[model samples]
Target chain A: MIEICEVGPRDGLQNECKIVPTAQKVELINKLIEAGIRNIEAVSFVNPKVVPPMADAEEVLKSLPKRDDVRFGGLVLSRSGLERALKTNVDFLHVVTTTSDSFNLRNAKRTVDQAVGELSLVINEGTASGKGVAGVLGTAFGCPFEGEVPLENVLKVAEKFLEAGCTEITLADTTGMANPNQVQEVVNSFLDTFGKDLSLGLHFHNTRGLGLANVLAGYQAGVRRFDSSIAGLGGCPFAPKAVGNVCTEDMINMFHGMGIDTDTDLASILETAKWMETVMERPLDGMLLKAGIV
Target chain B: MIEICEVGPRDGLQNECKIVPTAQKVELINKLIEAGIRNIEAVSFVNPKVVPPMADAEEVLKSLPKRDDVRFGGLVLSRSGLERALKTNVDFLHVVTTTSDSFNLRNAKRTVDQAVGELSLVINEGTASGKGVAGVLGTAFGCPFEGEVPLENVLKVAEKFLEAGCTEITLADTTGMANPNQVQEVVNSFLDTFGKDLSLGLHFHNTRGLGLANVLAGYQAGVRRFDSSIAGLGGCPFAPKAVGNVCTEDMINMFHGMGIDTDTDLASILETAKWMETVMERPLDGMLLKAGIV
Candidate 1:
């Protein structure tokens, strides 16, 4: 079965208005469980006022039903957040850094050396606890502030994370500024360096409408795991007009059309996406949501 | 220097509701030329009644100034259209075919073999007279009617056209069904097969918004020549719901951002795009038109 990591709760809710109640977050999680999503990003333990959407992360985590098959994860920006996630009995923690030096400084409030140092700390902490850790290289494609990030910059971040014991690494087209050639070059470089030791995944936004194409590029470059939000729900709040993530249902449909077996029910996912749209009170970025699975 | 090919006259008008006046079409061509478009596809020679937008093809061709640097080409669908183009002083003719059987039948009303046969006649007649003949493979990336056009299918068409003495073959992501992987796979195949006997170009739509990404992929595969419409104008009249082509301005921005010069004026082309948008009475598909070149 093709790996589908549902990032709706973390990446999805982080961009929305009308902060979902903790119980409703639980309801969403329960629904995802019912839908058989094996890997779910439960919440981001960030400041409630900063991201009003995910303010109730602790309550949501507490309300989750412990299932055998599903793995729970959280998105964390710093060591303090990672520590919070470690205490919650989660399976994974996603630590993010920007590949572009300017973006890294602006987004993370640190230089490359500072961000790399923090990543090493988080990776070490997760490994010591016997939990999987993932490093997400934000702005892996291109940067709004910096523009056209060199491939070597992404490679450097990946090398630092891997050296610090990151078991999984995801390259993010954070601003939807990445094209497929850049995706191929970065992915191919990682593969050349780490091979099977690194579990490579992709995080894409449809800012310029390249979400699905970039994912396809990743798949072609031998990445088996992907992160997508239902209804293409989220954008970066800090990243200045960042677009939605790759639509989960559309990605599944494309995969299914290609005879690649992704263990996702497109019909059910589409229905969930409709629910998301109603909750967010916004139009979704997913094409299949409107066109249906053709 | 960016190579700006004005596809607005062909693609931008083809999708409009009102039939563009013959004089307006000529004015648009003149404006694009004034904006410094060295290569322009003047108009298409198809059934006038079927595509009323292109009904005044002969008049439009006649209206253009006889400039050595500015190329005038017509999109030809059949042998009759090529015959008509031959009668005119068109510098070149662009013949297209769909890689998928369904799209070929639906769009061109002929099977691939039959379309190739028709294309061969045009190539033979046009090239023998020292006028350039080019083939554009529609749905080279993916088909809206039939999803996932096989590489073998595109390769077969390219081989047929190359053997028939076509000067260039452009892989078109008609309906924006192309991804970077598909773009690279198809373009690499052409390079491996025909080498330098035929030049490879890419034409992509921004429907699913991989247009620029697909171009990047083609570039990585050693394809230097590319086809883009100004202000992202132009979708196939056959593909009723297809999105616009890759924006000429955006592609130029990408090239300039990457330190590659295409020898075209981006700011002036954008001004021309804005003027054309006013004439067309609609918003263009080009993002750079709204976002401006950063």
Candidate 2:
């Protein structure tokens, strides 16, 4: 069975122009959990001035339904975000840094090495507080500003994350510059370097419409975990020309259609995607939302 | 190198609510030629009343530039359409029939065997006139009305087409109901039966967002030719909930990004897709048009 992490609450809503209410965010999480999604990135503990939509991260986390089957994660980019998350009931902490210095500088206002150094402290603190820390390396495939980030840079960052006590590592195509061939190569390299026992996840953007194809490549290369957003929500505020995250319902539909068990209820998730469309008050990028389940 | 057949004019424009002027249709073909697309399904010779957008089929065929490097094709569903196409300067003829009786009945008002019987006569007539005949089996993957079309039915239709002097066979997922595993199975079966010399092509719809993924599977299974539409234009007017065909520029972008040669200039095709967006007077479904080349 493949695993999927729903990133709608945090990554999906963070870039929206309108701020989603803490209650609505909590409710969306409730709906996803109802759909049998166990792992969800529920909120981001960042500066409110930087991302106003995620200002109520603590409130949203506090209001979540307590379930042993569910895992709620919060994004932590720095010491401040980690501290804020530590005081909350978030089940996990997701620490992110890009492979390219240009992207890391723009996203975190620090170089790649500097951001790694800082996030290492954040990961250690979160782990010390008994939180499961997941390291997400953004622009692991390619960077918008730097064009092509070397695979070596990706490995270096992932090594640092492992050394800093990250329980999981997710490679993110931040601006959707990855193709299937690149995904296969990166996935194989990661598995070869870290061995098959390493917990590896893949996050993709649909900016260029390659999200699912990349997922298929990653799966074929023996990596199973993926990160997606409902109704294709969320683009990076720091990444120019970035679009929505890979649609959660659409990816689930692909998996179910392929006779692969995702242990997720597709019908329930599709209904939630439709509800998300109304809440966003706009048409999102999900194909299943428009075409329905085939 | 892979071959791409631009189907924007015939399959793409046929479903548009607005009637595109015959001159604009010719201009679109000219732009496609400028972008190095050699094979083009230029027009469909169906009843003008049934498909009003293709009312000027003869006029569109007559206005095309005569070039030795380009091969222009016309869609012919029946003996009447074949006769009409014979009167024009169309370089080749594309005869289509679905494997499922439910789809074939709705599309051409005939059963699968009846379509194969009548289209065999059309293929003979087109071949007699020295036109390259390509047999397109629509709903070869899955049908909107009939859930799953068996592989035996697909092979039966293809075998009939081959016996009728068809030079090529293109399997079409007319309603975007295909998965990657299914594509791999079908493509491998076809190639295994027909040998490497068989000219096999794939046509996919992006309704469920699996168009490119299916294309990847087809390619991995040894298919070298694909059909795509500019700006992802056109859906079956008869197929409920059907959306656009796979976008030409976006698919090309994927091929180019993977270091695979498509032999089509992406920048020029992107320019034409931008022009098509203005012609359609709405946002098209292509991702490259919105995100630009990565």
Candidate 3:
């Protein structure tokens, strides 16, 4: 039971400009279901004017394929944003904060303490509504503006997320600057501290080509759930000239080849990603989508 | 002791269409030497027509700066090629063989056994001539033609190279398909078997963007020497689809940032790489060359 949570519809769409028609967004999510991805991040409930790419989140949710077995999630950055997500039928609400002070200020327009406070509120509201809550800590490894984030800072952030009633915590290498050793040590530290209090997940970028290595480190450190974008779409607009997320098909191919059970059809994911690329009208940075995963 | 071994004049040139002027190759090597790269791989002694990019190897060598600290080496694939190298005034000679049968066949047109026989003869000649000898085990991690090369096979080849009286061995991720775990395991096994009877080095490709990961893995496993081309030059003509060696500037940037001492100045190496790029009239693949590692 390998869990691969597709973040393309939310993370990928939000990062780039080529906006897909709301109906086509539903088609892509439905196609992912047809290809057997059970856990897909469908969209985000942010301001339409700010992140124009995800303006049709409500429409995208209304047109889903209606599978009880599959769980759909949406990303949210603030408590007010959670109101929009609560209106939809998303199975989980994902919230993100950063370990670095500068990144939090730059990306979320809040200090780390402020962002964590907001996340706690979102967690309380989501649990009250009987929905899953996920906490994503961005720039957990290193930050471009501020180099070498301390391990203690990350631990404190994770502790805050878990204490705030987050069912799951995702450590994101947001800047794609994490090395293998750092990934192993940080993930292991979290596991040792929290154990079953939270389910751990990884979100990595392929910026310096360390995505697979970081994922391997996370795997060795006992992480099973991960967030990947189809065709490696979605760079942080916050990051200056950043690359996309780890390619979904390539990640699946590597995991499957290593006898890891990732319930993903690599070929079908490629086909769906290709369709997204056609609609986007720009080259999405996914390798397996183009290379076809030998 | 930071040892920067420039492989651009050889590795970078061997895979290109435009033949760099012999004087420019010599100038590039001299500039690297002035910039404090002590060990520079001068050129490869191979058939000129087979690789038109390296056709002026002898002329290029003749024009190199005369410096006692800067030692020059040449790459050769067979006994005959090593014999050709013996005619040059190179400080060292690098002999290459592949642990993977398919890669060895395609790269050098010889089986492992045949390559070993040639290695023994060349080692003897190299030792008698009082020149340093290094053996490069190409595709030590994974092969493009045949993937998932075993650690046992690579270790066995290393044992043979040590037995042939070679002093140094370079474990090459020839296709850049190695993960950090694989690198650590292979390097650990090599260190266990060789026990410093031979020095261990790494040659990596950024094809899959695991170059730095592999390098870090090797370092943790106790390897010190590494081969890198300026601007990440010189793909395998046989495997042109794959990326080439790790960029010298990028490696230096990582090591220097980590407080590890590399004798080469990153800025100077970058400047020399830029000059080489202009001389070769092609795009250089090294990220630091473009990104300017802040």
- What are the interface RMSDs of all the models? 4.3, 1.9, 3.9
DockQ-superior candidate, 2 or 3: 2
Instruction: Name the 10 consecutive residues with the lowest summed lDDT in model 2 chain A.
Output: A234-243
What candidate 3 gets wrong by more than 4 Å, as runs, is: A31-36, A148-151, A235-240, A253-259, A270-284, A287-294, B1-6, B34-36, B144-156, B235-240, B253-260, B267-283, B289-291
DockQ top scorer = 2
Give one digit per residue, the lDDT tens place, for model 1 in A153-201.
8888888888888878888878777655567777888889878557888
lDDT of 3: 0.78
lDDT of 1 by residue, B1-294 (tens): 334566778876786665678888888788777766778877889888788788788889888999998898789888888778888998888988888889888877788888888888888887887778888888887777777788888889888887788878878777776656566677777778877555777887666545666776777677787787877776433454656777787787677655688777778878888987887677766656655665
Candidate DockQ scores, in order: 0.17, 0.68, 0.25
TM-score of each: 0.79, 0.98, 0.88
Q: For candidate 1, give the docking quality class from DockQ.
A: incorrect
Query: Which candidate, 2 or 3, has the higher TM-score?
Result: 2
The residue-level lDDT of candidate 3 at B193 comes to 79
Scored against the true structure, residue A65 in model 1 reaches a CA lDDT of: 87
lDDT of 2 by residue, A1-294 (tens): 889999989888986656778888888999999999999999898888888888898788778888989999988888999889989899999998889999887777889999999999998888999999999999999998989999998999999999999989999998889999999999999999999999999999998989999999999999889999998987543455658889999999888888999998999999999998788887777888878887
Which 10-residue window of candidate 1 chain B scores lowest in summed lDDT?
B234-243
lDDT (tens digit, per residue) of candidate 3 on B55-158: 67677777877778788989877666777777778888888888888888887788887888888788878878888888888888888788888888888877
